[model samples]
Target: MTMDELLHDPEFIELIKQYIDYLKSSVLEINTKLANGEYHDVMKFGHNIKGSGGGYGFMELTDLGKALEIAANDENKEECQKYLDLIEKFVQDKN
Candidate 1:
């Protein structure tokens, strides 16, 4: 469904915007942590993204985040990168 169809409530849109902003911030933070080899922080950030994305009706993002979380848990960098790429594409498409 289109976002407009999936989200009828204006308040929900506002919440979604907030969640997206948070997602963007978290992406930056997580990327920084990953660059520094702080894998634990990346996992925590992925968990946050999974929860918040689901709460905001961004199911695709939530699924990607969940995958990232799993990869992070396993310290599978390549798998996590795949999920992150999906998320970036999803967000870009939304815009």
Candidate 2:
């Protein structure tokens, strides 16, 4: 189901909006940490997103998060950046 269809209640919709805002802030932090060669933090963020996304009815985000998590685990900066870009795009589109 689409996000709009899943978020039927106005309150829940607002909550989703707030979550998206939180994600936007998180993206900046993740990017900064990634630049500093801190893969652990990025990995943690990806794990968190992976766990939360499906619960929030965003499977695409979950999938991207999984990819990011895997890249971070592998310590592949280039791959991580690619997944991060995809995740950022998803967030931007949703927001």
Candidate 3:
């Protein structure tokens, strides 16, 4: 089903809510990992976001995830922070 229909489907409401919650918590975890200089975990977090965002009909999240992955690979604190901010903002907007 299309994202709009999926989102509006009563049966999918709980699943969507869970996905959003996951995104929220994951953002916090990734931020903490970045702060701790844990590039490996950060990259893994980004990878997870990349893999799952589209399944939840959040394509923008996929792009953000990719950027985050590259940022972690380069150990770019500024870039990581930027993408994290974008992620948090996107989640907030969705809510």
Backbone clashes counted, model 1: 0
Candidate 1, residue 38: CA error in Å? 1.1
- Give, for candidate 3, the lowest lDDT window spanning 10 residues: 10-19
Ranking by lDDT: 2, 3, 1
List the candidate 2 regions with Cα displacement exceeding 4 Å: 1-6
lDDT of 1 by residue, 34-87 (tens): 667677877887787788777677777777877888888998877777777777
Provide the TM-score for each candidate, comma-separated.
0.81, 0.91, 0.91
Count of backbone clashes for each model?
0, 0, 0
Candidate 2 lDDT tens digits, 67-86: 99989999999999998888
What stretches of model 3 exceed 4 Å from their correct place? none
Q: Model 3 misses residue 32 by how many Å?
A: 1.2
List lDDT for all candidates, in order. Answer: 0.75, 0.91, 0.89
Q: Which stretches of candidate 1 lie over 4 Å from their true place?
A: 1-6
